[model samples]
Target: MNSFLLALRASPLRWLLVPLVALDLTLILTRDGYWHGLWGDTGAAGQVPTLFLGVFAAAAAAWTSSLRRPSEVAETLGAMPRPGPQAELPRIAVVLCVFLVPYLVGQAVCFAVTASSWPPGFNQYLGYLLLGVASLLTATGLGWIIGRLLSSRWGAAAGALGWLLIVMAFDNDLSVVNGPARMQPDLLEISLRAAAALLLLVACLWLPYGPRITRVSPLPGLTVVLALVATAAAVGNPVIDERHGSRTKACVKGPTEICLWPEEEKYKPMAQDVLARAENLPPVLAKPDAVHSLGLVYTEDRRWGGDFDMDSGSVWAMADGLTMAISAETFAACREKDFKGFEAQLKADDQSVLALERWLEKRLAGGGEPEYREEGMTESMAKAVETGKEMADRPEAEQKAWATATVRNVLGKYCDR
Candidate 1:
């Protein structure tokens, strides 16, 4: 313990820890709220902070490990009354603490910032923290191994670059973009990553302390295993169920109750206004049923860029949720035994559904002719629009009945005999 503390005090690498942690915290504080709102998933919100910590932690570990290059002091320590691994354990413990303590502190600050807005369940938040800690531990192990194997001058740089590449691979993978896995946290993926990290750390512990050997070692076997497991976990499961199911939602009451994901609570007023607008549609045009709630999911694009504006995006998302709610109700009332076939028909007639959406949007904008037309107007859409105009020309009583029937028909609930 004395030797470890002495080494820490003497090491120049210790200085890097503070800057790295400060930079990470700065980045997290600046962007977490926007990310949380954009993804609407707390697990996804953890990615940025974790990625930053992992990359720098790996570099710091490598720098620390490289300082121990097979010196007389190392030899003297190894030659002590204790076994080599036991003798070296305290130094490793110190290194791990140096990297981990700052990381955990940064995580706590990030979590506190997130809690002020999203307030995720305790278990879910802890799970995210654990996932991040596991990632940092894996990076530290890999960095230590790399530093021990390579020259001190180049080891830290190599570790940093290698960890960066690994993170980029996960971030920019084509499968992640094309598939359902949009960088959100999944239990299966996190578990596999943690397992791979553990194996790598174990292998690093077994790494020889002296001169490099020509013969193949158990390290190669461990490396191969790690590679295979990480590859299989990343590529094999292109999609896994996200862990957002456990998140608690905050709700508000009005003519229709509006419930939103925790991160989206800041936009509750906007969401409510959208709902109020939706409710304002004439009952004859399509009175929405009792319930209303927003389905929060990760979104790739925003209507605006720069300075984290969520107004347009949140309003549009709320509108989409209202449309889906009405559709769900219509589908539930559907008597068609072949739901698949019914769904297929509904999709085919989506233009009519979209026309209703356009009409609703226009009404929300204060009942004027829509300034722009939706592109690629299908035959069904044109017919629906013409029918809507004809209904508007009819008497109030007849128009109301027709509008209700039209909405029901569009939703595939009331089929003509």
Candidate 2:
């Protein structure tokens, strides 16, 4: 291995490496599967470049190994190769080109057949190219080191395994984007992080290979493994734990609470207070239901947890909130003739109302608390209950008038103060 490294160091091929690496990288960045899926709308559009990168990286690894094989070493030695970094670098460069051509050709086909546009422009392409080259070179270097440490075949196997692990861990949303073409680019970040870790692993595998021949070594390969593990821990955390499917699942049970799916009727106004206001100036107060019908609205097109709980004082706080949110959306959709937009708004509003109700309920249920005073006419009713028991012997009409006056006074205070 040392002899091979020295030979490579002495070869003229070294300078060609930079350009070959750049070419392969450019090819990968330009290929996009833009229209490959259904409707050409990719929820997973971000991952196309990473997929190409992985393929290129694997091919580059294999080609590099074949070029650096022991047979090549023997032949180079027999030819009395010039002792300079120039000679071997050219061979590495040639190998890189050979590996790159087939990969680039496939990408060309992918581009032509799909007629896809690289989502970003020249600057973005350059950025992706640089990123791809860095990742591939790192993998190649690591594969070279692994081959050296574990005999050629084991090294090749290690390289292949590393590549496979990276591709698998790229965060492809197979579970969701199935059956139709729904591409997403969200996994790109994860793929990039995985590729980076692979590169580090390659570095780790190679850096110690040169120094271990003379000194007593304690597993010269563990450094890369540990580094890869740590990177995975940091970059992979959010991807691994994300509850992607749960975004559509039912999470909210009541009208007053928010969840992915809220329950019915919790927000279906028993009354028609859709705007949360009083109407009917001819003197009767508008029914509370006429304005404050509970319902959920889908605002901003961002799917979130259903409405939060509002009717907490009731035995079924959660259920009530969920129910209200769903019903509200349904009700709004039915009313507006803009069924789609109405449903969306109702869901959002249900979420809002439930939140308000739950907050208010919490305030009302407290002790010596100011919230109790603000709970509409509940205080007045309690006072009425005490006074009514004392006036139990009064005639019905007199009692009714007195009660009416008291109720009007209480509700009037609520309206005025």
Candidate 3:
């Protein structure tokens, strides 16, 4: 214990860890709020501390391992009655604690701040935290082994750069780490990755270090085999796990209930206002009070520019979605019949749907002509618009009945056929 404390006090690398950890924490705090309250953002934020810690930890571990080369510590320790592994345990423990303490604290703080507002999936967050710890262990262990074996003056720089490149190239792109947009990695993937990292750490720790010409250690070889197996388990499964968090919805009550995913709850009022505009249609055309629900689907399409806005295009899209939902519900009554040969019918249905969408937009804009025009106006759509205008000229009751029937026919027989 005394020797460990003295070693720690003597090592300049220990002092360097403080500034690196502070920098990592600063980065995490600054970016944590940028994408707050969004699905997958929490796990992504959790990765920030790991990103900075891994590089510094690897470099520091290498430097620490190199310190023994200039001294008689290893020789003196070997001459003692105690075993080499047991004697060296304190130094290894100290180094690991130095790297891991900041990581654990930073992650806990990040999770706390995010959970207060965003409330992410606990299981997923825990899995990512475990993965981060395993990653740090792997990097540090590898660096320590390299330093011990090579004793190169450039070992620290090489360790830092090499680990950083490997992490950036693989961690962000691999599904086992961040997963794809709108998805989170499966528990199996996280588990396998964590296992592989730990196995590699074990291999680094157990493998004998020498100047040249050595036989392989059985423990390290077995660890390498197990690590490969764990990696295979991660890479073999090709299916991207769909994110259930995105489907988890919270609703706000109004004339029409506005349902949105929790990440999109900020736009509930905007969605309510849009639905209230939708309520202005004729009784039959308006959504029924019994089944009055508007589910907002948020798209990350570049054209949409992300999030709800008062822009004409965005308003039109929201109004269009309301009309589409109504049409879908109206068509549900006609599902018993089987329709075939739907190629032309599908085109006609699209035209009709677009016409209805345009009509709804005009109504929502207070019966004025739409200020913005949609691109790619098809000929069939123009004909449908003419037909819609004719129907609008009819008596109010007749117009309502015609609109309901058209939606049913188009969605049920026309689209399906």
Could you say which candidate leads in lDDT?
3
Off by over 4 Å in 3: 1-7, 32-40, 66-68, 115-120, 168-182, 209-240, 244-248, 253-258, 261-417
Error of 3 at 153 (Å): 2.4
Every model: Cα RMSD to truth? 9.1, 19.2, 9.1
**Candidate 1 residue lDDT tens string, 345-396:** 5656655545455444443433445444556766887876655444444565
| Shift in Å, residue 205, candidate 2 | 13
Which stretches of candidate 1 lie above 4 Å from their native place? 32-47, 66-71, 114-120, 168-199, 210-240, 243-271, 290-313, 323-417
In order, the Cα lDDT scores of the candidates are 0.54, 0.37, 0.56
The C-alpha local distance difference test score for the whole of candidate 2 amounts to: 0.37
Tens-place lDDT digits, model 3, residues 302-370 = 221222222122445445555555554545443334544245556445566556655555444334444
Question: Is 2 or 3 the stronger prediction by TM-score?
Answer: 3
Roughly what TM-score does model 3 have, to 2 decimal places? Answer: 0.58
Candidate 2 per-residue lDDT over residues 1-417, each given as its tens digit = 555556457544445456544554464345343223211222222223434444445444543443443566556644665643333344444434444443344434434433353331122222232333433444454444444445444555666677657546655321112111111123355466556655554434333222122232454446556655655553444432212222232322222223321222222331122212112111221111211112333334564223333321122343333334434542332344433543543554423222323322222222122212324534544554334344433554564455445434433432232
Which one wins by TM-score: 1 or 2? 1
lDDT of candidate 3 at residue 257, scale 0 to 100: 60
